[model samples]
Target: MKVTVIVPARYGSTRFPGKPLANILNKPMIQHVYENVSASTLVDEVIVATDDERIKSVVEGFNGHCFLTSKEHATGTDRIAEVARNLSTDIVVNVQGDEPLISAELIETLIKPFQDDEKLQMATLKSKIKNQEDVTNPNVVKVITNKNNHAVYFSRSTIPYNREKIEVDYFKHIGVYAYRKSFLFDYINLPESILEKAESLEQLRAIENGHSIYVSEVSNELIGVDSPEDIEKVEKFLKAR
Candidate 1:
């Protein structure tokens, strides 16, 4: 299957405005994310799908492929669906623009689920939450999976309510997602379900609609720039390594 990475970058953000344009070292944050995905051998090509012209220009300045999507898109997945509609690739990986430190190996790992199983329509990554603070934090979304490694549910609330034990292994959901090209169109059209609306997670719509999502456990903790302070953390990480 031809795997292409599509990054949905928007200039306007409620928490941190102009998040995509924020400088990390010398380059824009989105550019760093684009370059990281571009370096991956698993991805056939990387495209920046955005509504802003400035974001398009920044991507093009670095000689990267970009597409101007409609501003009406309610979510990142919806924006990615627009780009997927025009592309001929079999698989589209929706890499978040905020995560500049996303590893190429993690992209490769997400792509592997398709090779192993044709039944999986979508796939995402997760890591076991070891910290006690993370377990109770609503900001950190947790996941519970079935025996087959298919996700049963995803939520901000701690899953599996451990009445018996205080420390059962908790898995935090990572935002990176991979979807089959054909499924992308259908996913966007699906109406939001109660669980989805309550959780504010777009992926839950797929689950509620009876689609399967395979989970891959990744070791790396994805560092995403949610606020201006996070830029320094990413810079220090990059410089140290």
Candidate 2:
């Protein structure tokens, strides 16, 4: 099946303006994300979907494919769906543009579940929470999965509460997601979910709407740029590599 990776970028971020174009190690953060996603062997095409012309121009400047999406989209998934709707492909991957450290290998890992399970409608990555502090950190979204590896729930609060002190492990949610092109449309049509709104997480909508999301556990910890401070963290990682 053909897989396309779409990175949704917007210049207007309430926390950090022009975040997509933020500089990281001398290259635009979007450029770093685009180039890495392009390196994924499973991806047949890689494109940037943005509402800003400035973002579009920069993407083209780097010789990357970019599509200008509607500014009305409230979420990054919506921005990606606008571009995916016109593409003739089987699967669409939404890789956050802010994650300059996202590796091609991780992208490949996220796509593997679909190859193994044709029935999987949506999939995303997660990593075992190694640090005790991370388990309680609300900023670090945690996810729990069932025996089938399907996500049971995503929450800002620590899950599996361990009220009885069992051997349960916590997993921090990775933002990258893969969706069957048909399911992508289905998701957008579903009404805004209570859980989604409460947690400020888009993935919760699928769960609330009675759809399953496969959560693949990966080892790599990718730093997603949410604010200016994160750029320094990314630069340090990149420089060391």
Best-matching candidate per lDDT:
2
lDDT of residue 6 for candidate 1: 96
- Which regions in candidate 2 have their CA more than 4 angstroms from the true location? none
Q: Please, what are the lDDT tens digits per residue for candidate 2 over residues 1-241?
A: 9999999988998999999999987899999999998998899999999989999999999999999889899898999999998899999999988889888999998899999999999999899999999999999999999999999999999997898888888999999999999999999989999999999988999999899999888999888888899989988987888
lDDT of each: 0.91, 0.92
What is candidate 1's lDDT per residue for 12-87, written digit by digit as tens?
9888988998999999998999988888898999999999999999999989999999999889999998888878
Model 2 poorest ten-residue lDDT run: 160-169
| TM-score list, all predictions | 0.97, 0.97
Q: Report clashes for each candidate as comma-separated counts.
A: 0, 0
